[model samples]
Target chain A: MAVNTIHREPPEQSAYRGVRRVDHSPQIFNNQPARYYLMWLLLPAVLLLAAISLYPFVWLIYMSLHEVQLAPGKSDLWAGVDNFTRLFSDKSFARGWVTLFKYSALCLSVEISLGVLVAVILNNSRLEKLFITIFLMPMMMAPVVAGFLYMFLYNGTFGWYFWLLRSLGVLDGGTILGNKSWAMAGIVATDVWQWTPLIALITLAGLKRVPQEQLEANMVDGAGPLRNFFSVALPNLYPFLLIAILLRFMDNFRFIDTILIMTGGGPANATKILPTYLFDVSFKFFELGRGAAIAFTLLLLTILLGLILTKIFEDPTRKIKTDGMD
Target chain B: MTSVTIKDVWKYYGKTMAVKELNIEVRDNEFLCLLGPSGCGKSSTLRMLAGLEFISSGEVFFGDLKVNDIPPRDRDIAMVFENYALYPHKTVFENMANPLKLQRMNKTDIKERVVWAAQMLEIEELLQRKPVELSGGQKQRTAIGRAIVREPKVFLFDEPIAHLDAKLRSHMRGELKHLQRRLETTTVYVTHDQLEGMTMADRIAVMHEGVLQQLGTPGEIYNHPVNEFVAGFVGEPPMNFLDCRIEGAGDSASLVYDNMNLALGGEQSRILETKGAAREVRLGIRPDDLTIEMGTDHGLELSAKIFVTEPLGGDMLIEADFGQDRMTIKRKIAELGQPGDACGIAVNSEKLHVFDRDTGEAFF
Candidate 1:
């Protein structure tokens, strides 16, 4: 029966004609009800967030130029660029830069290393879902509460850490928090402990996108686990690692709330990062113009760092470079 | 080239079996096709040979060596996947040379081999282009070239030409057959398309539901299917099965079904005469063996009404209602038979197939 075949009027022409013909069907264009429903659904959230969130940002930039008086019914003065100049001259602001760099370096380095290690371990685990949920618990905790909790843990005398360190001959100090050398260390530890889970989560997400077929193909090609990780896994995780570093860098820069709750800029201003210094200048000393200048400068630093990290991290040709290898 | 042998191989994922006790011998330079419908375990069997999948039980042999535990790289087999798994970022030359590079062949040797394979596949000019820049047929050719350059002991192909358009599929089928004849590397090709298996394979292994139904040359499968499944699956407008019972004695003995009496003449009459009217059987008849007529014959005379008439370019397919059941007859395209026209069919007794109704096995 090979010679006998059946043919029908090709369905393609009819389908094309049907699609081209318009029937003035109300279902096609009468979408005002859906539009009205969508507007209603999004309107409340838009109004509420705009009122409570973005309005303050606008007001903050406005108040940054003008000085507010405590006296009732008193008008403020606008001193443009004056606060910015004073902020530049302040040695504390310079120290804030040093502190910011030191804290960010410590936080990002430890978190990235630990995050990658944990993500690698968790990725192949049988209880991957369970382990991820358990590991991400620290990041879910409030950073301020976590910092205060760690502060108590690092107490000198009555705390278990001090007694334990004394027993180990590593603690002759009255308190680890009291020493300028250990103050920044304490801040870094708090930030790292709370935020490392974020890095782990993002890294794990990246690991998930790496094709299983590619890995299996490598194995069939006689590449062992170590070579696969170095050649395939790490190179594939490039964008994720970049994103993790950028996020940690920005988060570490604005990590003043936890440090404030834990050490309050510490003994001799050792842990006085930009955010804490900005808080001290603007709220504590009421140097509004200087504080606003430092805040804006910190904002600029964040944007600059974000742009650089994004450019490096989101290199679209990363896939071509890695899989491009023969 | 080396022979590849699967020795009672079984593959299971958890409790579900993917392949069950499949045993096939691929002689040196033989183009054997594992042909079946989807989920029929053809691809899994090919993958097991390629060492891309683990064998749950039984051993696979490369030449005389047991390769159950040998890795794919050491197994010296090249595979072309259905999706044409070319390294998208690399030039076609680089993709083709990867296996040779893995062997640490000299740069000149790699270049020579890539050029030779590319030229054979008529893709020499496109060697420097990436996979995304090539058409579907071009990419498939590059994938084939990549496998060819390896010069492996065996070649495994998993539905490599399935993604091409219908016209391209037929064109590439001819090219693949030519390529295989030149290379002759004991290939094991897998496909769900029966026509692919028929056209290219020296031997086709027909499978269904992880069970091997028949293994033979394409002609053997078409003329002598071992069972109903094979009979139904092998041919286009597949072999029609009509439930009928034996009647009469000696030369007068015939096959009788609802509303028709088939007169078995010649060898079929003798075959049915000895096997009395004691059992029911399925009459397997190819469409070409049945003629549409307007009158009675010394054959089965069943009146039918044409439900549809499809006039193909060279032939026609007439679907008609025989009693409560529907049957189709193939005829010349020049027939004037239209829908609702009454007609009769003459069964070609010389080509009649009597299958045991219980087991669906041929009772010739």
Candidate 2:
């Protein structure tokens, strides 16, 4: 009875069953390795990057070896290593690197410490979202705009900050920008005001990623608030804090617009960091060759500093490992 | 060790009440399990005891000292969370030594205690490894080891073994029970698994929807559940409830369903008579208490067709379909029959449970 009731194909399907089968192998284009195809797909983006960034960088290196002339009739002269030699001999150029080192160190340390404090406080605050939004307003503004705003605030004649500082005995009579001793302090203050929020936001995101249960466990383990912060929260936040510091350090190394617009390396060149000094040598002094040499030196310095920072802070052991069982 | 008492404790998250007017006393060195389903306030009660959660009102006492305002660290209680809550960055020895370190204990003594705990938990070899290097059961053992190393006044467990696989969970259950017995600490364990509660707890406090359903020893909870929920919840296969109506008020009273009737026994009728058993009542019976016969040669016979049969090793669970209701009956595997077969069901009268339909309160 089972054999009689077995399923049988229709006459049309049975007739076509004997026909030859077509080959279904992939075509030649599809047979190639996936990475080979991906390389072809990414060629356009690579070329675009070279055109915009790599080509200009190469051209700048070439121009640094020669004395470039902007006039159409004047021929460019081979200066050899004269531009590089002049960068080291120039007193303002030497002072620019020193000034930048000091500024980057001071600004980064202050911003990181303050940012972590603010993030911790705000993380525990009831109005965290509202306060975070308010704190981030300065970072959203254009750097040139912030520079102009601080320039007005530092004006001795009608600026409210100047008047308040004078009333408070902080500044006796001189403008903060015009005074050689106070000019760098004013620039650092402006940079801190505009950039501290970025570090705080990054640290806050890291703080939120901390497993809440671990904090509660610490409480049960007899850890007070301060001990909990040091033993549990801080260890978990190490990677994020390091990343924030590295990014802030790199950004501050090349800092230019605020100081350029506000001080213009003025007041006896007290605020002339590397980037501003390069601007002065290239545009103000019309010495493009020496400016390019300084730019290249700054790039090398940044790479060296970045490598050192990464080596010190980018240890993968900083991450808290979990068994992934949970 | 000290006794813990919760008096009129209410926990509220904003306006929503998570635990309502709870009162329980845990004697010194007693193992008490707060048993419930999810969102049933058992964890909240345990957390309140641990001082991890704030009490909205009322007082928690640790041997006459009110601890409503005391922080968790000062409360002298250790907790094992469901996720094991081991510090990922710390090794097992460090995790176990943390509490002692907080108390400014010397390195030698902290190491001694941690080693002792690790040995007791059979995790001495894992002491050098971090939590990330341990498996689920090993991590749980470390968590327990950490708790024991503190020698706190009380131990709170929030479903600590709920994440383990079945075999490992059962194995760890025995280990935890034996360990608690040895330590003699006042322990409050929370779990949604009834088996864990029944097997481990000296006294089981069953809760439902933020209210305590019943609190008794395992035997008492199983045999004399105060309400329908407790009866249904405390059992493995759960109690079967059949809707019926009471007919004839006096000695001739019987429970009647569609075309079927069961005479009320003397004790049950007397209790129902005094309680004024409403016209409608639910017949609650455990699957194990129901006897199945191949044919009708029994007292209070229920004609039913077998819906399905699940062979559970020694015992077979059969779903029997009556006129409009289905009930589960446990039978010996050797006596099991196929589905669609007609069978006679004889309910054990002494084990029968009757609840008022409206209030769901068990009468007998």
TM-score of every candidate: 0.83, 0.88
DockQ of candidate 1 relative to the true structure: 0.15
Candidate 1 residues A79-165, lDDT tens each? 777777777678988998998898898888899989888999998789999988887788888887897788888887576765777
Task: State the TM-score of the second chain for every model.
Answer: 0.94, 0.97
RMSD of 1: 6.5
Worst 10 residues of 1 chain B by lDDT: B293-302
TM-score: model 1 vs. ground truth: 0.83
After superposition, the stretches of candidate 1 with alpha carbons farther than 4 Å from their true spots are A1-54, A67-74, A158-186, A229-246, A267-270, A315-326, B86-101, B104-135, B248-253, B263-278, B294-300
True contacts kept of 1: 0.07
Q: Tens-digit lDDT track for model 1 on B166-198?
A: 877887777777777787789999999999999
- Please give the distance, in angstroms, between residue A222's alpha carbon in candidate 2 and its true position after superposition: 1.4
